[model samples]
Target: MDTKKNIENISLLKEKMSDWRKLSDEELFLAVKEFEKMPRLEVSIYYQDLFNDPKFSKTLLDIYNKHKDNTKLVVLLVSAIGNMIQRYDLPESKEIYEFMLENSDKSKIGPYVAIFLPRLKNFESYDKKWEYFMNIKKMSPKKVAESSFETIMDLYLEKIPEHYKTEAIQYFNKKVEESNNEYGKQYYQDIINKIKS
Candidate 1:
């Protein structure tokens, strides 16, 4: 880790992030990017906490618009959108989620978007997101797992009709059998348990 970045991270995290609204959008983006040094799970919470002020929503949207084609940056943008949705329940997330599906692949930020898309009211049913997940299936196992498996499996287990739920389990089981990766098998099994119980 770069010591400069580490120091910057410590300084930023030390402050009350809600006060970060005073910072310009570029500064805010820098702060958000500083989170790259963190464990993946923590980044979203930091985003949620810091960017809660609705003023920053447009900042995030603008950043995402400008860098959507940059694969490295897009992950952070997707996490920011997910963070906002998780923390504030913002109503306008359909477009951000749509952008994720359009620009991201199945094995990358695609799974994260697949998971969150249903949270918006328009996706009360699972079909649209499900179709998108399948489209990304052409990616490698690691990629598909990264892109769709985690999110879509959870979606079926929680929200879909009973028949569809069983179907998802079966579908995942098939994938597990086809997969050479033991980790993927265990993952599918874990998902099966989550859905069943």
Candidate 2:
């Protein structure tokens, strides 16, 4: 679906899912299990709205603990937990980070953890996190997978602070030069232009 349609769908879903906030812990896990069977984008839209409930963080971690062996769901859960950490002071953030750290060696998950794990400032100082994030050439992908180039670009575009924009653009330029993937090179150029403009 297009962006506008996705927003409308999420809004509609929010109306139905508001009751999800009030669900008991067990009930919430049941709800998550049902969500897991749905399309990824739809599941993402639903959980993105669901994460607004502070109570949901524990359930998110619980769900992670149960399903960490499922790499596809783990990616979604890691991203959700990362979003929750960014938006709230959840106690589960550290454990969630550790979980992602344990799974970071997987090809599909590594680039995502590389992108999202650095967002937690408690684990590392801001400068140190940026140093690590900027140095990961994998974050600027020559090949896209479940953790896609678009997703990585979007996260960097959304999360990059103003002070880091210049450094990010320079980094993108370097990736654009070194990458053999034509689409990846163009994507880097496009994002750099977006940052410039």
Candidate 3:
């Protein structure tokens, strides 16, 4: 599976990323283009390290924009943002959240949005994140089970009003019906059970 090539790419990616802090905007832009060309293997290996540097937050968003068409890369990038939000004091957190809220669509990374967005501090209630999830659900119920619904249930399960729990249970059940992936269906059912109990 091109392990040697992957190793070489990883080395090159690390080498380029090492100078990110010193690079000017112009140079960083050029470097980010190089990052866009990186395969998922190498990107996955280093994304957290890169993302954890709060200094790189704006650049990370730039890299995200560069890689939007690459869903796996986007997911890794989004997940990195998730990690950054939960663990670090990111100055760009609001901007990053706004960007994701505006540009994100129903794709593999969509659920990560649901998972991470609520975790951003001083924003809206769980209701806003739920609204985002519900909007996406309106478009694709199957996407609900991918990642966000579980996070939604976990985060808002207790915070939400009783009536919303009943509504969420209905959505979870719909997700179970719509998901063809056995694992995803099971996940939805589990959340339904959690809500019901």
Candidate 4:
């Protein structure tokens, strides 16, 4: 049951998605257009449900490709992809992770990619997965180290490929030593110790 909603009107879209779960496919497309215009926090609140639907995912991905320079929308899109990756764990999401790597910034959506990419597994090698994490190193040192450390523990706990765990630890440790951000270093040390024990 689609409504005669104008997709270009952001406020109307948000109002319509006050109960987002009940939206029709056509209405959802409009909601996605609205979400593309939303702040990250609002998008995060709303898109969690949308990411569960494969159709919304593909649509959001298409929107993602369309908005390369639109950092806000891209972050929301990558977050949607990451949330879907975390929630569903289906299909090859290496491309999504790669997109995050190439397009997302550390101060922005990079942390999401840093943390989430380790969770995805494909039929083939995780060369791209590791490459994404390694690419995070080029971002602000303290933040990358701090954020990635958590994902390292997640990898260790998830038992995602023995070699992958090894690589995550090595990268995490290197960043910890290099970063002057003491809080980040302490946080990393705290989590790493917990994972070790």
Please write out the lDDT profile of model 1 over residues 1-197, one tens digit for every residue. Answer: 55456545644643523355676766655665664333233334333434444455555566667655565566666665665565545445556656655654545556556545545566555355555554444454456444455565566566555655666677667767977889988988887777677
Query: Candidate 4: lDDT over CA atoms?
Result: 0.54
TM-score between candidate 2 and the true structure: 0.46
Clashing pairs for predicted structure model 2, backbone only: none
**Candidate 4 worst ten-residue window by lDDT:** 1-10
TM-score of each: 0.56, 0.46, 0.56, 0.50
Best candidate according to lDDT: 3
What stretches of model 4 exceed 4 Å from their correct place?
1-50, 88-98, 104-107, 128-138, 141-145, 157-197
State the C-alpha lDDT per candidate. 0.57, 0.58, 0.60, 0.54
TM-score of 4: 0.50
Q: Give the Å shift of residue 38 in candidate 1.
A: 8.4
- Sorting all predicted structures by lDDT, with the top scorer first, yields 3, 2, 1, 4
What's the C-alpha lDDT at position 27 in model 4?
62
Window of ten residues with lowest summed lDDT in model 2: 140-149
Per-residue lDDT tens digits for candidate 3, residues 1-197, read: 36566556645654665555666655655654555444323334334454345556665676666556766656656655565555443454666867667545545556656666666664464345555655554433355544555665667666656667777888778879988999989988987887777
Which pairs of residues have clashing backbones in candidate 4? none
What lDDT tens digits, residue by residue, belong to model 2 across residues 1-197? 67566656544443434465576656655555444332334334444544455555566666667666676666666665665555433444556667766755465666666656655555464445445554454532335332443454466676666787897787778879987999989978998998776
